[model samples]
Target: MINNSKILLVYTGGTIGMIKDFETGALRPFNFDELLQSIPELKLLDHEIETVSFENPIDSSNMNPEYYLKIAEIIEESYETYDGFVILHGSDTMSYSSSALSFMFENLNKPIIFTGSQLPIGDLRTDAKENLITSIQLAGLKKNGKNVLSEVGLYFEYKLYRANRTTKINAEHFQAFSSLNYPALAESGVHLDINEAMIKKANRRKKLIVHKELDNNIMVLKLFPGINENIINQLISAKGLKGIVLETYGSGNACNEDWFINLLDKAIKNGILIVNVTQCIGGSVVMGHYATSTRLEEIGVISGKDITTESAVAKMMYLLPKELSSKVFKTIFETSLRGEML
Candidate 1:
């Protein structure tokens, strides 16, 4: 006997939560309590929908670790009661928020799908309706009487991707995100086609654990022509800075200049962790592959492999506060813990 699944809809603020004011012709947040009134198609699904929204909605730019903790707390409080979760978020930084949540929840066994739209739900041609309707349907899918998607993921533009692997690529296009080094977990057309082989399998016996503590003392350094030592020193020398995401050239190459090496070396000696992530969108960072990168390898820079910037940031936040030794940090950063890297 198949029982109807209960899905929790968490609206964390985005175009999907907005509506156009008739007189002002401007967009404003909609009351999700009236969800069925706006998208009645939801009533046709075979699942029960419950909603929770932020007391005061926040834009994607304002999203932070505090919000991530709040979201995790909600899921933790209702974990056993719900079969799955669907998060409505702003598109601009949805990838970052989703990536952070991926790390926050360990040993997850239920689907937590994050999605949003490029246009407000109230718009006549809004993408929100289809996105919301499909996301709910995806959340309720089951295999062998258990939730089908057992990991964190992002559903957008007709494709579902591993949340930690995705990066938003456009602001104007309806198809706004891409998983550079990974394939879509599912696709929606006339019928939803799930790539079962690509879905992550969870450990059924391990209890879900939510990690709320995240360290925000991290920086991102991008290498470019004419970037002076003074600028580098200013950023690397900041007070209490603990981690850095170094966006290097192709294959993780960077200027082999003495001053640059000296600066990085000094930071490493002071216990600051530096991760070498490639600036290229579609390739992995292969440290020591070339003479130029061998110097970075010598100074304890950890290669991020094929991890995206969003995942790198989230990983640093999750790992930095654990007080792991520099050696341990290097090992963990290089090791693919959640399928975020190659």
Candidate 2:
């Protein structure tokens, strides 16, 4: 065991940090000082564990790019001091935050594992203890004297997935997240098993560059039967809109109507980036596979391939502030910048 490894546990507010008050039966936030008391098993782990929490813990639904930048700055400031980071975030928007972090950092050489539970940590059958403990263990994993994981990851329900490839599938279930288009990077059962071939290798020679600026002037538009032009036009013409994640039908098929095509074309022509991702939980967007999607490809709509909407949004936000030209942006978005797409 690598007992010498040091890990920073960042509690950014979620069910994992909540404890039920025995007297009132009301849930209240617990200080990290008592973390050892609640989860005594953590003391058994060989690695050194330290914790930090947000001044005002927030619900995951309230998460935004500003908080995303805050998380990145925390890791950036302590990048060299700690071997790894374990973030306790709300499961609802965990994927979004994790995906955003994945793109905000370049040449990352340590694991940034995000985790949270469906139930409060004080609940009798809560999954918080297991999730918290295993995440720390994974973060501290070392091979050849180097960190085993070099990319952002989310660990839950005995599985660790590439953060950008994951989505919250169920709110009520203990197993809340899924990476439909990607495989688990690691799985826990009787033994800790890691898929060595699936991990993203980092360029350790390069210095880590943390990007602070993120543009959130984006929105997701889902296509459905009987969708009209009025709504679409309003969104496209909305002031300050920079990008759109169009959740199209199977395999990125859209309405294909002249009105639909013209609206999207106008958006792209006006410098708005449109990313075509599928509404299905699993499957890649193969533009031009169908006649409906063909026009989208011809109109300069970037194919999201197998990337999730969560990732597409984060990638868009990360890329927008760079001020890349339309041509450069299209090429980079289509390309797998962080192993987000095939």
Candidate 3:
């Protein structure tokens, strides 16, 4: 058994940290330092708990890379002091932030669990208390004197998912996130049934390396019926656009029209990396599957097989502007990094 495990609770603004005013019936930020007062059950946990918050809590819609860096800095500053971290963030962009964090921390050896609730924590029927309580439990979990969850994860409702593979699927339901291409690492029911085989094993000997350089000069071009050249051109011609995520039809197919191919080819020739991903909810992007997709493969478009949009964006942001050649970029994007793509 591990001794003296410390879990840091980073509150970056979300419904999970809000309390409803009795008089006005409005939600406001609760004092995270007073966590025990709000959730007395936290005292039952087996580890020391600490709290940190953003100076000015912004909604998740306003979340950006700067805030991401701030989180990384906090983790870096307390890396040796804490065994794990639980981040409270808004559900709307939780997946995006989690995905970004997965790429930011290389070779992580501790849990960085992101969680939030659909309702404010102060509400009687709110799901925040359970999520917060379980997240803390998961963060402090250990086996053989080491941390159990050593990678970035999202724990919600009853499932714990790899951060990069998750997406927020519900606005009104308690289970707001889903992992489309992966299995849950752990499930909370009568007990925390951990899928030990599914959990990512970390190399504890490796020192933590934080990657802060992210290239954001990229655009997502989603294909739709009757999409004209003008619309395509506008997206491709965006200033300083260095990469494009071509959200294609089934099996990575798009309009076989020469106009479309020419536009894509020109973008490729101009040194803009184009990646083809399926728009379907649950299928791999299989380039060259049909005549519709053959042109994309022939024109040097890379396939992002079985990767979700959130992972694709995070991968691109982490990869682009690096010293990689076009050929190398395609190879890496198609290859599985951190099990984001199968």
lDDT, ranked from best to worst: 2, 1, 3
Pairwise TM-score winner, candidates 2 and 3: 2
Q: Give the TM-score ranking, best first.
A: 2, 1, 3
1-342, model 3: which lDDT tens digit per residue?
343479999999988889999899988899998888778888888679999999999899999878888998999899999999999999999988899899889989999999999999999899998899888889889888899989999999978899898888889999899887799999999988889998898998898899988888988889899889998988898889999988998889999899999999999999999988888766788898899999999999999888887778888988985858989999999888777878
TM-score of 2: 0.98
**Evaluation by lDDT, superior candidate among 1 and 2:** 2
User: What is the overall TM-score of model 1 with all chains considered together?
Assistant: 0.98
TM-score for each model: 0.98, 0.98, 0.97
lDDT of 1 at 304: 94
Q: In candidate 1, how many Å is residue 284 off?
A: 0.5
Deviation in Å, model 3, residue 173 alpha carbon: 1.0
Question: What lDDT does each candidate get?
Answer: 0.92, 0.94, 0.89
Q: Candidate 2: lDDT over CA atoms?
A: 0.94
Candidate 1 least-lDDT 10 residues: 1-10
- The residue ranges of model 1 lying beyond 4 angstroms of the native Cα positions read 1-3
Model with the higher lDDT, candidate 2 or 3: 2
Model 2, total clashes: 0
Per-residue lDDT of model 2, residues 1-342, tens digit only: 354579999999999899999899999997897788778898888788999899999998999999998899899999999999999999999999999999999999999999999888989999999999999999999977899899999999999999999999998999999999999999999988999999999898999999889999999999999999998999899999999999999999998999999999999999999999999989999999999999999999999999999999999999999999989998999999888999
lDDT of 1 by residue, 242-328 (tens): 999999999999999999999999999998999999888778999999999999999999999999988999999999978999999
Candidate 3 colliding pairs: none
